[model samples]
Target: MKIHEWQARELFEKYNIPVPRGYLCRNADEVRKAAADIAKPVVVKAQILVAGRGKAGGVKHASSPDEALSIAQDMIGATIKGIKVTSVLVVEAIKPEKELYIGFTIDRAMRAVTLIASSEGGVDLEVLAKTEPEKIYRKNIDPMVGLHPYEAREAAYSIGLSDKSANDFTSICLKIFEIFNSVDADLAESNPLAVRFDGSLVALDSRITLDDNAVFRHREYYQVDEELSPLEMEAHAADLAFVQLDGDIGIIGNGAGLVMATIDVVAHFGGKPANFLDMGGGSSVESVYRAVKICLEQKSLKALFVNILGGITKCDDVANGLVRALKESQLKIPITVRMVGTNEEEGRKILSENGIWYLDSMETAAEAVVKSAYSRN
Candidate 1:
């Protein structure tokens, strides 16, 4: 879950990481008051879950309260990268002598936390990684041993830091890691970690992405307002794990690993999955029905795959739900099923009566679905 920049700033402050004085303003009047209180040049930054806000005209500098108010009035309701800006952060504007980048995230391939740093900041890290890979430094931090003082120092020096600046850099890196660890964050970043002319460092901008699986451990961080599409919202309301993707094949499974493997099989068969829907353990007929219904809600799906290795969840229940859903919807979209374990014979019989044959092998079903999805061509 991507929290607004102001929320990230609050986390930074909580961790004793220095940041420019700021106020989260929900209205132009608040922005005006914040600027007036600061009594200096300030930046009005649109607080939306979008990247490249500056290029989108969501960021503006104001030297006076009136200018801040004008900017805020123009900013509120403005859309950046398809997300409307609902609030703005007015902060003391600092002219940095140099800008740097620091971030922490999971390196899934390495099975460790990856610390990313670069002397070149004020730009997208992804673009920088692609365009000038040599300028950035990546360090894989082992969660067991944790980041050492020397390792942080190493990261600081890698980004061309030296002396006092290097020491400060190392400290901030360690501090952000603390926050990342405490919050179960998937990603934590401070782009344009500004070095003022007087040589003090401050986080000019900040954002954190929390691990959705672990967010329940930190309810204090939960926001009533999150960027969820209509389908996603519906899934959330139903207590189902669903993620919409850009493909024509919809996938539903009983477990997260099962769903992920199903998606991989689809891709391996030269097919794309439109969505991921996990029914969870001990799923009922109603749950399966809702999952299928939600999967069909996406207009892009040309085919559907239901892969279930029933244990706590019975296969017959899944089959019954599928039969009910397909018959009720009466949609022409093809659906493939792979069911095994716990009343498998009963499940197969139920599906066969509905003219839907069940497959035992996941790969075969994936291959068939891919062919079906492209058959219209």
Candidate 2:
């Protein structure tokens, strides 16, 4: 799950990490008070989960308390990347002598923990990786031993920090690594990790993304970030696996592999899938209904293709879920369904009686779905 800057800073504080002094305020009056507490030259940051906040005019420099309140007022009600900014984080501005970037993330292809650091900071690391790959340094961590002192120190030195800040930098890196492992996070990054004039390291920006499967171990940490969009909040609230894509046709299936195949088959047949939605194995009617509703909710979606291979998931249950969804949601677009295994005939019969379209083969289903979408266009 994604969290706002304030939430990430709070989490950092819990780990004894050095973060800038800040106050989260929902109103202009409270913002003024926070600005006063933090003193002049504060920063008014829109508390949104989306990126590119700086480009959206979500971050502003306030030279005085009055300006802080004004900037906060402007940002609190503004929208950034479709997310309504209901609050702003008022933080003390810093005088940084140097800036660096440090991060820890799972290297999926490598199947190991990867630590990355760069002498450059305050920009998208991906862009940096593409343009100046030599500036970024990466090291693999052994899960059993954790990040050793020598390894962290080596990363710190590699990022171009002076020998004086090397130990402090290593300490911070160790703590960050601990946080990543403790929370089962997929990524933990701090851009512009500043070295102040006094030579103290502090995080200027923080981002943490936790593994969805690990949420079971950290339920308390799963508190919803108030800055998320309504659609995002609802998707998480419903616990439906969803990934937004860009295409005209929406493809959904019961398994992850099946969903991938559905998208691939559609693409092979000259159709682009708008999203990959999976109901997962052994889902109920409510879950299935939510999956369909979520898929149909996409404004770009021209049609839905549901392909399910029932082994542990019964075909009848899939059919019943589709029927219930059709009854509940007044979906105007056509849906093409393909069912295989375990009571497939019964599922096909149920769908036919409900005025829904069904096909036996995956290729035929994909063709029908693509045809329905293009026909409407």
The best candidate in terms of TM-score: 2
Candidate 1 residue-wise lDDT, 1-377, digit = tens: 78889988999999889999999999999999999999999999998776677898988999999999999998997777778888999999999999999999999999999999999988888999899999999999999999988988998888887887888888999999998998999999999899887777899989899988887998877763446788988998899988888888999999999999999999999999998899899999999999988888888789889999989999999999988888888878888888998989999999998899779988888899899888887
* TM-score on alpha carbons, each prediction: 0.84, 0.88
Best by lDDT: 1
- Count: clashes, candidate 1: 0
Error of 1 at 313 (Å): 4.2
lDDT (Cα atoms) of all candidates against the true structure: 0.90, 0.84
After superposition on all CA atoms, what RMSD does each candidate show versus the true structure? 3.4, 2.8
Clashing residue pairs found in predicted model 1: none
Clashes of each: 0, 0
lDDT score of residue 201 within candidate 1: 82
